[model samples]
Target: MSGDGIEILRLGARGDGVAADGLHVPGALPGERVRVGPAEERRGVRRAALDAVLAPSPDRVAPFCPYFGTCGGCAIQHLAPEPYAAWKRGLVVTALSRAGIDAPVAPLRDAHGAGRRRATFHVRRIDGRAEAGFMAARSHALVAIDHCPITEPPLHRAPEVARALARPLGGGGKPLDVQATATAGGLDVDVRGHGPADARARQALVALAGDLDLARLSLHGEVLVQRRPPVVPAGRAPLVPPPGGFLQATRLGEAMLADLVVAGVGEAKRVADLFSGAGAFSLRLAETRAVHAVEGDAGALAALDRAARATPGLRAVTHERRDLFRRPLLAPELDRFDAVVFDPPRAGAEAQAARLAEATVPVVVGVSCDAGTFARDAGLLLAGGYRLAEVVPLDQFRHSPHVELVGVFRREGRRRR
Candidate 1:
């Protein structure tokens, strides 16, 4: 394998530096001349190994994390903030261009300072010693870590918690997935990849939870010790989300997204929140307007319902547990709402978008983590005569390739085509 000096021209979709000859080299940056080894097929693409950066780019900065290149959690930590933000915003731009939809895309909002409120660590017994941390980059090999800077203070202590939990739970050589979520009360931890524990192990786990001062501890959704309910504030109420429930990575990111969605919906009296997880936007919007929250997860909907009922000063906030992927609300059903807000999974709400495209809703707001799927759905709405008002990118998951965006769509008249 010959090491050839290749000049990186741009960053690829996955944050890998790309050469003009189509060579993708990891850990390289644009305007940098890096010596790369022969390309090797990885995940269906031939990627060259970064040997050395012969000429460093002006935009390259020293990574803050010690495990920046080894840990798979972050991929673009070496990039400067300005270039990094531009590359992320360009992800949305490239996606929209590919979908053939032109809209006024806003500058990306930087909301990654609060750090991730949740982290899922891998735990295993190696050489008769318990170890816990994130997996290595693109591999199942576990990298034992003492700390992570990207996570919040509570979540950063997840590795220690995982180790403490594994001592009581793990006897076999199998790896365990420990999900730790930070709450105002304390850390809510969920351990997976192990069978039911015995009476002794359960007691040990209970003691460990007290030692760690965790708000709640669960084993594959089964509660071990619940000192207090892990509650998250939504609009006017505190919602006790289910174990391992989906939440925004950072508190500021959630607020940024919720504010954008609220602005998009305007003063619409009735709104439908589809794929609403734990009422992030639903609860907030319900403060000013009536919101019909629909989601696939029964637990999340239940939490939203309970929070909505207990909370005061909120308008009518109704909910339904329905899979928008398989069965989306039809045009007739959508007509009941003056505005609609949907935040689907990474796969996106394709079927729901089709229905919304056909519906004559005055205002529609779309929130997504996947740019490709968002653009596809936006194109469908554009083809159906909805005007793409704004697309704002949010750096929720910083130092990583993932980006969240909120798209505003409005249709004044009847559906076209």
Candidate 2:
């Protein structure tokens, strides 16, 4: 609570209010319309209430999805497109500031709601019928819909095809993660496995692949068959991902990330790339830089090695399939590096981050898809005497709450503060 002129309610990073009197108000996450009392009523428990402005600061328009309030897929669709992009950029700067890092922030371009190559929709049997759509925003109940504009045409076909197959998903079926990519061969479907659709269900599954003209087929957790893309000079990096292997669903997004990672390393001669999956960043970086990639997936590494052998300039890339969670690279072994880059999963890197703080690397770049976890790991780097320099947020998942950001961190000068 401030002086007699104006009272401060809940202090926010952007000087906003979370709530005034514990009443539930909606609109915009990390946003609240705070109450400002007149000079006369400065004292007391600050128990005043005022109408909260939940709009996107005059920068956002109402969302298009009717199930926006109930669907878990999107969080910011309600925002005006321009303002939504601005808010995301601020999120990146704010995250970097939290890490005590201040560098040049870059403008995010092409922030649109298109080119979604991958999507996952829920499958449910409604009234003894297979219906496909997202769930209610806060509930697991299905909002059966045939088409999702955000998804690519082929991926959107998943729901209708599911209904045609009428596959029985045991226990009402669970969430299905369907990934797709546009390549020279055509659109490919990478269906991530889900619940068991019994023997009767298998018939329905096959019908889906055939009806949709899918270039690839996959069961729960398996890739049945994939239409191989034309092999350009894949460089010494393996691009043949195993059935469940993690491949960049979007080529454009992956290229941007890989470029940022390579630039972040500065003049790194020998660097360690952690959580290196199928050399997404590692192999790309290896085109010019030397890398010792660390990951837990042996199969993924095997594929990457196979790619490396085929690549001409891949002599610089090496990999070790180690469980960094159980055992991280020791400081002595890592002390020789000039820079480091890590693109960890949603969990972020807790143990690995701690070990990185003490490492002798100069520049460290961490790419994260999860904001909260990025903030957490950035905090660790800040404590380790690294200055958060730059953060670039990518709205790869449009109309959704998810944000992908890349932050470049630099080691502070060796002066004890």
Q: lDDT tens string, model 2, 1-417?
A: 432222223323221223544322223333433333332222332223333333324443667766665566665565566656666676667765676656666776443334565555566667766677777644678888767766656556766654543454442355454444443444455544454555666665665666666555556546554544422123334366654456554556677777778888877777788898777787777777788888999877876777777777564778898888889776666676777888888889888888888776788889998766888888888888888787778777676556687888888865322
* 300 Cα displacement, candidate 1 (Å): 0.5
Off by over 4 Å in 2: 1-19, 22-62, 96-105, 108-114, 164-208, 227-238, 247-249, 414-417
- Global CA lDDT of candidate 2, please? 0.63
Error of 1 at 331 (Å): 0.7
Model 1: per-residue Cα lDDT at residue 196: 85
After superposition, candidate 1 runs with Cα above 4 Å error: 1-4, 415-417
Clashing pairs in 1: none
TM for every model, in the order presented, reads 0.97, 0.77
